[model samples]
Target: MNEPGDIEVERELVRAMNDSAGNEPVPAYDPQQLAASGRRHRRQVWALAASVAAVAALGAGLAALLSGGGPSHTVPVTAGPAAPRPVGSPPASAPDAARGWATMRTVLLAAERYENPATRGTVQLGQVAALFTDQAAFTRVWGSGGLGATCGAVADGALTMDHSGVLLYRGSVQLPDHAAFTFDDRTGRISGVSCGSGQLPGGLGHQTIAAVFGSQVSGGKAGDGLVGPQVSSLDCSPADRPLTNWYGDIATGGGLAVPPTWQWQVTLNGDQADGPLSAVVDHTGLMTQATCPTSSP
Candidate 1:
């Protein structure tokens, strides 16, 4: 069963393929095709990752799905998931998120994302000092190497509370990996920053992910790939959830090979116990997944 708007993905893919400069009619991709064509190849790569748990990195590339005779237009859109999608709630009765939480989240994410070698010890650090509760601690170990319990974006998307009443703020990177902060709303400071999982492979699309895992969702309440890795501890799903686009970034060289495309998906890496299983729908109705490293090397 396809998600509500999965047909839209297929329609969009067909439209994109039709508009390509020089190419034949492109058919909406089938997850099974991507799954079957690369069975042995995936085994080899996964075997390598399994042997070296630390080597579980994401592969980045433009999805050039082949058509009948051979691969054609660069169709790279994430697949759509059915109902029972990731709910931004844990087991507890999460309280209504503070209005400022969303605003501060945007600010903190940008500030952390902007941190780099050049910005080290610069005014930018002091500029966002008010965001963190323990400026010294946050600054001491701010850039990369991990921040929250899960190294990858185990708990991303909307905000929620845990059983202990701790705010599960977005604990991850703009890219490269995931993690979270146990924010103290009272003090307007992060009480906990954890990154037990290590950096994950970055910039992979749904085709790559579905090829890698076969899009079976071996274990989940829905088994339809929705309600995937926990999104939050809030207990209910939000009316409007944000979707992560998997467009090939020029900076990362994921688009130079072929024409760039767009994809949007919910977070499927919130349950730290379930490995780095990202779920997204590609243009041809394929779910994407990236195994974020469990621990740093």
Candidate 2:
């Protein structure tokens, strides 16, 4: 009872209904597409991890700088060798004798300079003041017309004798013409000075000789002659006794005129004594007898 066209239309309608009622068939799996998706996920994860690591490294570096835990830029230093000591220089701990010798040399050189013609034969009081403890005594001895004038007068002449000697504590430098300079052991001051002819009574005064020798010498009693022991011979005297034999005989109670305190006892050879025995008297006042070393004249 239906037409052919209507039957065809009904068939199309039924096909549509059937398509809507059933679910669509799934597409086939594609290996290439799956691999591409996995690669994209791995790349995203690696990027996130790298970003976290970079942030952590930056934070650590900042913390190290803030806490002062960074490496130092200061350079280290090295030391050099010590300097050497000079020759003939006495050590700090050396005895008074050593110091006295050095000081004596300085004083003598200064005196020489003062006596030079360049200074017009005038004594430099200020320059020589420090060399004496008792300045008054120095003034008395070397003042205007004092012994200093006599010393200046003869300074130009030939140096008949130049001697330096040290005793227990004292020291002396005897120049020509019976002139002598005495220095104290402890103070290093010029204790006394004498420049006179060796004639007696009108010659070297007893007080001057005592000062030159020391307190040990008697100031000269009525018959004691010149006081203390007198030198038996002149400077550079030929030795009458053997070297080994003690020359106690050389010292005598004032019998000879001009008792030579500063004598140079010489052996047959040409060597001279280091210093005169008078230096011993000047330093120690004959408190101790010092044996002179044998040497040529």
The residue-by-residue lDDT of candidate 2 on 1-297, one tens digit each, is 999999999999999999987867777999999999999999999999999999998798788889988665567868677566433232324464345443443344334334444533444556666666567855754555332623544232111222222111011122334444465656555555555544222121223333333222112232223324544422233455221100110122232434333322212111233633332222212322233344424
Looking at model 2, residue 194 earns an lDDT score of: 54
Write down the lDDT that model 2 would get. 0.40
Number of the top lDDT candidate: 2
Cα displacement (Å) at residue 98, model 2: 4.6
Lowest lDDT 10-residue stretch of candidate 2: 241-250
- Off by more than 4 A, model 2: 1-94, 98-105, 120-124, 145-152, 156-176, 196-297
Q: Alpha carbon lDDT of residue 269, candidate 1?
A: 23
